[model samples]
Target: MRETPSTPAPRPIVGMVGAGQLARMGWQAAISLDIGLVCLGSAGDAAARAGAPLMEGSGRDGAALARLAAGSQVLTFEHELVDLAALGRLEAQGVVARPSAAVLSLAADKLRQRRTLDTLTGVEVPAFTPVTSIGELEEFAAAHGWPLVLKARSGGYDGRGVWICDDGRAAGQAFAEAAAAGLELYAEQAIDLAGEAAVLVARSPSGEVAVYPAVSTYQRDGMCRWVTLPASLPDGLDKKIGRLARTLAEETQLEGLMAVELFLTREGGLLVNELALRTHNTGHIHTEAAVTSQFEQHLRAVLDLPLGLTSPVVPAAAMVNIVGPADGSDPATRLAAALAVPGAHVHLYGKGARPGRKLGHVTVCAQTSEEALALAQEAADRLEGNG
Candidate 1:
């Protein structure tokens, strides 16, 4: 009699710290791959609302990180604000954390990231100086010129923790506010931008890498409003973006996905804006446009599995974020109208309405970038009751 075949090994579990919108989307990808994705966050988190399994814990707590690492083959993150000391301790215990604490540091602290990237040749980071006092802010401004931006060194996102100071008085006030809030701050030269763009890079433990197209991003009040891949760029910028992203993945020894935000200067030069060591708002367009979604690619990378193809299936794909209007109307109530837009793929995060909050997003694909973004914007307008 022939011997019985044994059952195949289960795929490695990815324990994500932070069960917000990023993990909620990642959970959907895990469902399709039939893999386990456990998230650490509050019971009322977005992944919780989506019905994914969750363990109540703080990502910055050493015990909590250890707990998440115990049952997980590899630990990952959906946010960059976790305590580096706690993660370092967890890693010392033989627990694997993809995009290790070192990589996470490159994202957690703006000052640190700026210094680190400046050391890399061909990577240009805007001139900046760590500011802990009004004197330092004024000094940097005097040197870098007026119209600088004051940024929190850590814990800033979606326009918060950022202040544009056109003169000395405004800079003083912003610095005082950040100081009163007990935030470490820095001042960076406000770049003159012809356009804004970003790239998504996935690098597996085996060193296999995949880079997505350089996608154009539009920001309002410092929050990304819309994004479109195949951004019209100066000759050879796209290819240059791919090479730079690949270099970042390899040089950093990344074992998971990273979103590299870039600034397209008015002089036709590229500057590294920021880095997110997890799924980013800009990469959400890949869910509808690429052969493989960014979430799935993230999982594959952290699991050390062969990466998925990232080629675009459509000529152009654009996404518009569903921001809560001033009236605070729930986008879900307008779902019918948004869905009625031809070729619009709408996703609503399970969250209540609040003015200026990101409640959901809409993606559309078309033969041209303009048409794709126009349709996506139209659908988003309907969702926001603007249309």
Candidate 2:
């Protein structure tokens, strides 16, 4: 057996690729443990404003990643968009990449995810067909019916890189555009469902698991607007969902956080839609509502430590995303107004404000789901200049 290097003289530092808000807030978590949270950020990135040791470069740069990897105990990522080839290079050079390249690769490509989900015996996924050309798309649509969703086999997220085709003509047009842009496309039947739900699960290196309450997401233009935890589903559905979530984490051999996005059909059944192998937008409410936040759980799992308790701190909680406008005033005033509400916790991701950009989130806790949702909505409204 190969001997590992001795622990650093004092606290261990963890290097994170992509210094977005995730890395910024992770810095807060690292502070409590006195661990250095190093970030590989582009020059002048918003997270650089947080004062962490920022390695200015692209995550795809092997030299940059190596520089960040040196002296770090573990390496992880804030965003999945990081170049997997670079991570594989790092792994070849003996750097530790939590969740492993094998697992992350499955989450990186939508086509691979769909195939893997299909291979799993008990997992239920939406009916999907891969389309590489206009003819295939037309045939799939004709067979499956119209008004289908066209999704890029890779890189689709938060409403970006997704399109809906109402007819064969629209599908052919989308195919032309996608082909011209060198994009891979897939077709899926657009089910008439109640809404979307997400369940967050974390697994330690030793296989211990913790599952958070399942939440329903409200989306507009494919961007999540709000998340309500402990979703009002039929009795025993929560437990079943929790079991399925754990099964995914274990099957993936995941070491850290994973969010399973699902479609909750009107018939009271859940179909897994996608998986995010990182801390997720829908799980942000766990920061204030759960006894152990998902961020901390991620840290613990990635470090190969024991799992934390995942019980809810309140009966119900809701999280609303703060999206900025094309023309808006400084966010400080709006943040202050939202903070004025009791039981409302605001987390601002320090980033340049762009139309439809996720600036931050407000999480609220209350005795019931409705009250918590109202509080979260008020906070979002205040942040969006509705005050």
Q: Give candidate 2's whole-model lDDT.
A: 0.84
Clashing pairs in 2: none
Model 1 stretches astray by more than 4 angstroms: 1-9
Q: Alpha-carbon error at 178 in model 2, in Å?
A: 2.3
**Model 2 lDDT per residue over 98-158, tens place:** 8777788877788889999889877998789888877787788778897899888877789
Best by lDDT: 1
User: Candidate 2, after superposition: displacement of residue 99 in Å?
Assistant: 1.3
Model 1: weakest 10-residue lDDT segment is 6-15
Residue 339: error of model 2 in Å?
2.0
Residue pairs in steric clash, candidate 1? none
- lDDT, candidates in the order shown: 0.92, 0.84
lDDT of 1 at 276: 91
